[model samples]
Target chain A: MSALLYLVTHKLKNRVREIFHRPSELVLLLIGAALVVFVVFTGNLDVDPGAVRPRAELSAIIFALYALVFVLTAKNGFVNGASMFSMADVNLLFTGPNKEKTLLSYGLFSQMGRSLMLGLFILYQYSWVHRAYGVTLTDLVILLVGYGMTAFLGQMLAMLLYSFTSGSDSRVRLAKGVFYGVIGAFVLYFAFLVLRAPEGELLPKVLAAAASPVLHFFPVAGFVRLGTVGAMELHASHIAIGLGCFAGCLILYYILISVLDMDFYEDVLKATEVSFSAITARKEGKAQEQAPRNVKVGKTGLGKGFGASVIAQKHRVENRRGKVLLLDLTSVVMAVVTVAFAFFTKQPVGALVMSMYLMIMTIGTGRWAKELLLPYVYLIPEPPFRKLLYMLREQLPALLMQSAVTFIPLYFLLHCDPLTVAAFILARTSAGWLFIGVDLLLHRWFGAGSNKALLLMFYFLFCSLSCVPGAAFAVVLFQILFIPLSVSVLAMAALNLLLALLLLFLSRNVLSASESNNQ
Target chain B: MLQVNHVTKKYGKLTANRDVSFQIGDGEIAVLLGPNGAGKSTIIKCIAGLLRFEGEILLDGFVNKTLDAKKRLGYVPEMPAIYDMLTVGEHLEFMLRAYKMEDDGTADRLLERFELLDKKNKLGKELSKGMQQKLSLCCALVHRPSVIIFDEPMVGLDPHAIKQLKEVFLELRQSGASVLISTHMIDSVEAYWDKAYIMKDGAFVAERSASDTTEASLEDLFFALTEGGADA
Candidate 1:
């Protein structure tokens, strides 16, 4: 038993050392530490007025951030580009003289170091704040213990969620639906809070009642219960219950590890395979069935004609052409989802624009630019203008499809004027297209994946500048000069388009010249 | 026809290919013999238009850097140039799309010829190195371009696969494709190639026609050229 314990600790230490060596891990640790410090210092320094109780709101915010971190770290759980506990690794381990339980213990303990670090940091900061707020030493200790328990519970829950969703297409779909539904419900609740403060007052009671089981059993709830006890100066019963919750969480964690199976690793691998298979199936089916096979050859049999031979030569080259409808369909579906989410959530138009920007930046820009721009400029045999014309023709269907999705949803859901909706969609789509063009040009000039940070910075800047207040101020400035706000918007759109075109020209010329010089 | 004119490539201060020049006519099989890091692959890549070089290369009289020039060129890199996520069939389909080829049975026929038809649905990562090399050759040949450039094409092949590949090269040459193969497999390619260029220190040290070196053998000629015994 002592040897087994030693093996587990050694493995855990090695895992921690490996994680610390990674650049991303270092960055995350620093960010986590800074965030903890900020929350603690702010919570302690800024005392809210008329607050007879400690701020549960601030604790909820911190916990939410911790949950986000938990999700991200769990998703990126691979070590050195390999899964920590893959089926193949398990099989290899089984072949060795080491016992299965020992290997299992090592795997389980490997994940504990990072969780322990995050838990200790949160607990330490919260304890500092609690002590400063005149909490008793016993209560502070209980809160710290509760925080550690909560962090462990969060990691376990994340892993369990991953395990449950693995290799189950229907379960994944259901999980996504439930997740979206919960987010929608939260948005609705926030909207109610904003619009009807009196009704919002009833939310805490509802939440407290809903949180009863959590208060009794959940580790995070134990921390919250401790906070409530400290603030209200409650009896010893509450403190006892909080301690009981922490103990229960520890027991549950051990039980979970004991029951874990090889199926969990197999399921994760299968999930990846299934997802890729689905994509491949869809692409193959569509391309094979729908795409046209032939184009009419020019009748004037310039059979040996230079242009004809060029055309013949091009025809001989294997071109992977699919129907433009696939991309159009994707754009339409994405736009519809964005508009629906925005309208139902009652987000301002600016928020809708920002969401559209993010969508286009990630999905549309990367893919469309890779497919349309790179191929035309660098791969295909055509004049630059002709290539540009081909790109416009190819992308028109997708543009119209996205426009219809955006306009129809906004008109119906927001009760906006048809013309206004049209203008809005046009403006947003134009901006998106311009952004895609710019991204393509940047990618070509700087090399792919190089300007990701720069693009992100630009996105944030664009979002800030395109807010309602900024737009309104611009409109007022234009009106003072007796110019129409519509004209200014058009001018802004044109400017963006011009900038995109300029970048395109510069990239094309530079790449072409470089290629020529290399030759 | 493919021609490399005083071509040189450098990565930082280390020269990969220096003032290397060679030519392969239609229906000719020209092998580039070199040790590792001797710039044979660099010359092949430059000819294939996959890399930028200091000098000039021409594919059938057109400059090598153009997409039009590349359209007539087929390349098989030393490492299997295949998407791991894509199956053999999907890879074939993607090649067909890139080359703008109609959905003919050309890819299927190539697979059948290479005995890879049964494994066409398997992902490239699932295949053995020999099978992967065969798949790479199939993708390269599926388009039937006029010029073919291969870099270390026999590195990971079984003896049988290597023999089969030699037969494929003969077949491709018969079909009028100019072939330039870079490989360390001098002994195997000895009887197959019409002409050979032995490179050392980023330059071609010897060029010998099959007719001229009937008794000497390619391995002897290769060692002679790279061992600094030949005077350019």
Candidate 2:
């Protein structure tokens, strides 16, 4: 076990060294560290008298951030290109003569660094701002232990979920739906509590109730309680409660890690078989129904069309339908959920606008669009612009489908007015087209797959931060410049349309360049 | 010794292997010959305990249906299966950690033997196809299991790699480990193999022994058996 620990540490050190060695990464790390330090020290020095419950508020924020990290890390491929637990090293260790417990410990510890860094940052910031609740040595120890335990628990839970849903498309879809539903409910509940709360008493009793059990037994909860009590100068019982919570959380983590199925790793590996079977079965059923009639006439027509130039373009368009549907569905579902949650919380306008914006962004720049639009030119003989226009025409149904799915739910659920609905749809459609154009431009230059996803995520993040600039622009056009609503809308629409056309043209040229380079 | 007894594997409605049985004793090198989709690789994977089969595979009379039995067997998949981000040295280190092999000079010796010593620090993705194949072979052999199963192991190997692999198999045979290699490069390794099985559709149709007929080549036997009108 000691030797195994040593190996894990060595591997981790090597990984960290590799990360730090990269100039770009080093710069980013330095910038992030500087920002975090600036935020902590500056914020700590200027303490507000009214923020008496700063510790508790910070604790709640930390807990929420932890949950967000869990969801995002689990949803996105973190350690490996597949999942956190899907790293080949785990499988290799399992097959080796090493003790399973030792391997599990190493695996869990190896992946906990990023989570720990984030946790420590939050802990330090909270501790600094609330000097009365400054972390004692014992509190820091308890915080570290609690963070590690919770991370392990979260990892195990994610692995268990992957084991059951990884290979089963239907199951994965169902699981994702349930996960989204739970998150939605939590958000709604929190919003309700906030809206109902009196001024200076925004903390819900439910949050306290939720924290009590953990505060009484889990280390993470215990640390929060310690900080909160320390800040309040509460009795010694606060420390006792925090210690008890920490101990309980450790015990639970041990039980989960030790008692879980040993074959879980194997099960995760075999899960993809289920999805493959489901897809194959669906394909077979479709084939049986469509085979005879379509086979006889379609092949002849296709061959004749190929011989001539007339039908060549349509065939290319038809080939992209599946990909379009896939992208559209992902966008629509995310949009509907985001919007529906906003509507239920009585923020109907915000929900409508955000949903429309998200829908446009998701469809325009996502992996689905890149996969559909970028790859099929090799089989077709046409002007690159013509081919792209044909491809966009093929994607029209999917675009319409996405719009309807997003718009109908908002309109019906919120009883939105026609003008608001029109404004929302038109704005979203233009935004969507503009985004798709941007995505096409990026993809034409950078290539596709997960790289494209990463780029899109970064683009969205930047756009979100630049909302101030966007809002200022909107304000200038609408209020200061006194542009009429109709005129503004038409101008914005025309600008978006022109941008889309120009981008499409540029994308075609880029593709042509790439093809020539390949040749 | 490895014993495959009436083992069958199915993927939904498609049967990859059907009632296939074969045996290779210690010090014996057996080649599985087949065309594409001939269930050769399926049988190899089943023997290696990577895939569940209907019948039984026994390694030295111990049925390899459990993890314990599997630990004694080494499997090289058809593809070059190694983490792209990991260097050749790191890949070996991981294998050592996973298999609980001591950090001795065994892996290093294999690297030198395969002429991969210089490229040990290169990532798997940076390696040429042939180099990747060699790396994979080294990973499978690093733990030194009693039985080694190769599924199209020579797919991307250069002539030099092929020669080195042949030598490696001979060394493994001398070490008393049973070897089962499934490959289309039958003609190249034909002279070294002790026994060969020819598969067609989903079953082994013919078996040949070098001891029985030294003149008969695996390619001729494989073609004769998998040909359209050939009888099982």
Candidate 3:
């Protein structure tokens, strides 16, 4: 146990030392800290009382978010199991002189630490949450605790479920049946409540259904949400019931593990290996989202291409195997979820912003980024500029398709002019391409094997800076010159395209070999 | 022919390869013998044009980073870089198309020779390490490069695959293609290497040829040069 403690402390100390040693990373951290401070201070701004949304709506949304996360996490555990241990831990700590129970406690402790780190991102939304729901600082703290509890308890439930169901077909089937049955019951109950309300009052009815007392005692997610909202509302009974539920779950897990004396190393080994490979893939700029279990190896060859065009052909074949041709999982999820969000919230602009945010986060991990790591990109007999264009050939159509699916529906929902909607689509597609261009320039400047977290910070900073010129131009056109919104947006889209082209031209040498063997 | 002239590769202050110059002629097989971190792989990468080095490398009179040189040179890295999504056949096809070579039936023949014809449909990720190495070898060979560089090629291969690879090297030599192999396994290339360069501290300490070193075994020569008993 003491050795484990030393390992954790040493790792943390080294990480801190590394950050301080790197001036760029240290500056980025300071900038991040300043942004957090600004956001928190801005939360004190006064807003119209009548414009503030009801607390029930916010609680309902948080409840649904928790429920969705916990459910998906448990399902992942049922299929692939959850792992808090990395490959290094499995290799070093598991084979070392350590007790199994002590290791398990360490894993749980590490998971809690990760949950706490992830909760800090919620602080960025403090200003908006305050304006919407008039939440106090203490209430925000309670919300953070609720988020921590949900994430921590979700993993605990996954571990418990995995330990119980692994290596038993019947047990897995039984678990699946119970899981689906519970989800089905909740859906039917929610639908019943929503249908019983008047047709025009759908959002209110859905919120009412979520705020029902029956759901307050439901499980890890519901309990955490209940305790959070109860603390904010000063409801004594709700807090008691919610906290009691969590206590019960903790006691049950403790008793089971103690009584059973379970050996879970083998069960966790596979999950840990998968997680390690996924992390490695991310570091290498590969897309690991769609790890298909059963790929339909349809037609075998890279269809038809000469030198650099073979890269695009190869990507098409890979996308077919991954079943992500024109619209990938990210695009589909973004389109469906954002459209539904717009339907409920009646905020098409919000949906557009959300979709763009999701696109920026995911577009960096495309297959073209992985191509830079492979030798074929450099080894192919072609000009560097030609290779760069061919490498990104598949991305343009994919971006166009993604924009079409997401923004076409948003057109009618926003009730805006057709030309403006078209300009929005064009702007969105160009922005996605701009992100790819930024990624290429980063690889060219910093090499592919640089620290991903630091590179990601640079990525975001560069992307935000890249948008400034076009945004400023659009503001000048629309505000000062009194030009139409559609024309201003189209001008922004044109500038974004020009910038992307310039970036691509400058980063042509990214295909050239480097000292860092990214493979 | 592959020529590496005064090639020096450094990572910051640590020089991995120091003024390394070597050449492998047509119809010849040259082997680099070194201990770990002796700059064997660094020079191999330099010849393959996969690193920035203070050097001049030419593949048949073309600069190493030029398209003409890339079209003529093939490299098998220490780690087999097999695409997880592409099938075995697609891997060869990819190499063929990327090199702008016509379909010459060489891919199928090589797969058959390596006993991988039946698993041609298997994805690269599904193969074992040995199989992946074989597929990587097949990809590197499908284009029939004039100058081929292999870095630790026999590490993960099974005995049969290793035997097949040794035969392939002889065939390549017969075809008048320049071949350079880097390995720490002394006995692996003992039978076929026309010339051997023993490297230590990023510099070649000794060079031996098959005809010149008939009295002493190659292993003895390697040990003598690397284990601090002999001078350059």
The candidate that wins on TM-score is 3
Clash number for each model:
12, 8, 0
Error of 2 at A200 (Å): 20
In model 2, the runs with Cα more than 4 Å from the true position are A1-3, A27-87, A114-152, A161-250, A253-257, A263-265, A268-376, A390-416, A446-473, A481-494, A513-519, B1-232
**Poorest stretch of ten by lDDT in candidate 2 chain A:** A285-294
Q: Is the docking of candidate 1 incorrect, acceptable, medium or high quality?
A: incorrect
Question: How does each model score on lDDT?
Answer: 0.56, 0.57, 0.82
For candidate 3, lDDT tens digit of each residue in A252-350?
A: 865665455377888778778888988886564444545476778888888798888888888888888877778876578778767756655677556
The candidate 3 chain A region of ten consecutive residues with least summed lDDT is A282-291
Q: Which docking band does candidate 3 fall into? A: medium
In candidate 3, stretches whose alpha carbon ends up further than 4 angstroms from where it belongs are A1-35, A41-51, A92-99, A130-142, A164-171, A217-219, A232-237, A251-261, A280-289, A336-347, A514-517, B10-14, B198-230
Interface RMSD of each: 10.6, 25.1, 2.3
The residue pairs that clash in candidate 3, if any, are none
For DockQ, the strongest prediction is: 3
- Comparing 1 and 2 by DockQ, which wins? 1
Each prediction's DockQ against the real complex:
0.21, 0.01, 0.57
Task: Superpose all Cα atoms of candidate 1 onto the true structure and report the RMSD in Å to 1 decimal.
Answer: 10.2
| TM-score of model 3 (first chain only) | 0.88
Candidate 1 per-residue C-alpha lDDT over A1-519 given as tens digits, one digit per residue, 9 for 90 to 100: 665466557766886896688655666567556765665565554433453234443333334443344334433222111133544445555456765446645655554554555455444345334533434344444544444445555555445545555556786677557644654555465455445544444435433433334333222443445544543456566656655665666566545544654345453354334334434433321111122323222221111212112322222221222233424444654564566445433443543454455455344332233333211123333344434434333344456456666656666665666655655655555566555555445444542222233444444444434333434544665676656544555444555555556655654533332222111
